[model samples]
Target: MPKRNTGRRHSVSADQIQKYLQEWFDLDNKAKYNKRFKRYLNYRDILTILFDRFPDLKTAYELKEKYIFFNRNTSLEEAEKGLAGLILEFGDSGIEEYHEFYNLLINWNKEIINSFTIINSRRINNSFIESRNNQIERLIYNAYGYTNSKRAKNRIMYCLNKKDSYTM
Candidate 1:
């Protein structure tokens, strides 16, 4: 019988967890699904829609200038707050669907703000997390076949261990 490794223990800041969750959300099939067409939104269409809806506004442009001038050192909270304000200002419709969408956008903005706070204060680098993700993908490819639950557990263990051993 092959012995199962219990896996390494590691600590991750809440920001890192939130970032991972956000990436998972972005990659999820359900999130990409377009109910209207019964199809998934491809990357190009997603970018187009986002750009159309949130076109370059004067305030956002100014923020970008400030960010660039300051060498991209703006606080995440400030950036998120500005984004939430812009979305609320431009997308606010009294209609139910639009209202729900706006609220969801605001919630995401808040999540980003919180995540940035945790990440900036932490002692971890994002490259470590990304490398762990790559490792998990390789493992999945190598395994060929495994229960979904088992794969998920293995991926999580790999991420934790990678984060623990990585320094940056």
Candidate 2:
């Protein structure tokens, strides 16, 4: 889907579609559908309405959800098989946008599969590093422009390294 809302054309924005699908996935267990809504029934109704109005949106959402499911639940051994199935589904989806995502997965297939590894019951992933990078990027942006790389690095390290005051 396009980035803009495109209200008159009955097209949803990228953000809106992301919200809907993210709620549908409920990976974090903190999704709106889990807390505010009574059950899947309500979200199902909303999705039904959207799907009826824009069939392609439904296809795209389902296609994305399948990958989310596969990524979260599939074992390392099953990763290749599951990804192959997803690749076929993407090809069949007939939505051109999915091809780019499929290509990304293909390019990173080895790393993606390796990420399924678990150590001490924890999944091996780069979430912490990614979040830190995002925070540092935000700090840089808020500064309007950092002229000195060393100063920016020091500021980010200071912010990141400070101990939390809250007691557990």
Candidate 3:
């Protein structure tokens, strides 16, 4: 008889069940897939947190804030200590990709770390800033009822060049 090779087995965890249950009960998630759409956050990490069945939104938010600090705020070496513990908490959970990311983070050479911590630290996400400009234009449209392009340009210039605005 020829030897047969079976593929890897897949088993769902209790954490998975708890998460789905929480998702089932979440009114915000039911009303709209809120966190599913945000671009600034890592959806996978958020989903990982969702699986743990938090007691309240406040606690969930604290986890999310920690995630943001870990993933985005790369300014301080001290800030990364928590990320190591978080990655280990999911030990052998079959998430090889997450493990790989953790490895990459931990194994990064000093130059690369310094570059991200300092050079890239000045970069802020532009989506919100651009949207705010559009919001100001819309406000001009609504507040002054300026339906013409000339008025829109003047309003934008006024808003952008005002002494109160940092651009000035």
Candidate 4:
């Protein structure tokens, strides 16, 4: 018989769980499903997880505010410093462990910020293109809302080839 591969499943850390909750909330707010109630359910899940993780109201509020502030205005380096400071203040670990946690926090922060920046930049460009496409669609609909397929194809071809005809 062949030996079984017995690798353990990787466990998610509390910090990662918190970050995932934030991302879930951001995505859920913009998504529409069968009904409007789906977003509320997602919101409730986020709240439940947060409350379970940090039962103390004060600590939870502080953590929420810190995350929001950093997410909105602070850079990745600043956020990493804030996280490291919090860990140093509250964690009951030795120096080596603390250092490890600090390094992890910094790396995670950098990764999140870099990913967010790239995604956000793409979203901005996509939004602009969507807006322009909407305008083009409206114009086409107004001019030939019920035209035959062949005529519509001709119109699109003319629109595309118009600019190329006048190249200097």
Off by over 4 Å in 2: 1-46, 49-58, 142-151, 163-168
Pairs with backbone N, CA or C atoms under 3 Å apart (clashes), candidate 3: none
The candidate with the higher TM-score, 1 or 2, is 2
**Candidate 4 lDDT score at position 40:** 39
Residue 116 of model 1, lDDT score: 46
TM-score of each: 0.32, 0.59, 0.30, 0.26
lDDT of 2 by residue, 1-168 (tens): 646432234668999999998876654453245444465445456667679999999999888888889988999789888888888888888898888887887888788888888888987988899989878777776687899888877777777888733222
Task: Give the candidate order by descending TM-score.
Answer: 2, 1, 3, 4
* lDDT for residue 143 in candidate 1, whole number 0-100: 66
Candidate 2: 10-residue stretch with minimal lDDT: 27-36
Tens-digit lDDT track for model 4 on 1-168? 975434334899999999988886663464334253455345545656667775664354555465566656755446566655655543433334345655665567545445334354451125666865765575575675745767666665566556644321
lDDT of 3: 0.55
- Candidate 1, residues 70-106: lDDT per residue as tens digits? 3245465466756666566536433444455556656
Candidate 3 local lDDT, 54-130, one digit each (tens): 43443445544665666575555654455556555433344544566556656753433454444443633456779
Q: Which candidate is the best by lDDT?
A: 2
Q: Which structure among the candidates has the greatest TM-score? A: 2
Off by over 4 Å in 3: 1-66, 72-123, 131-138, 163-168
Q: For candidate 2, what is the TM-score?
A: 0.59
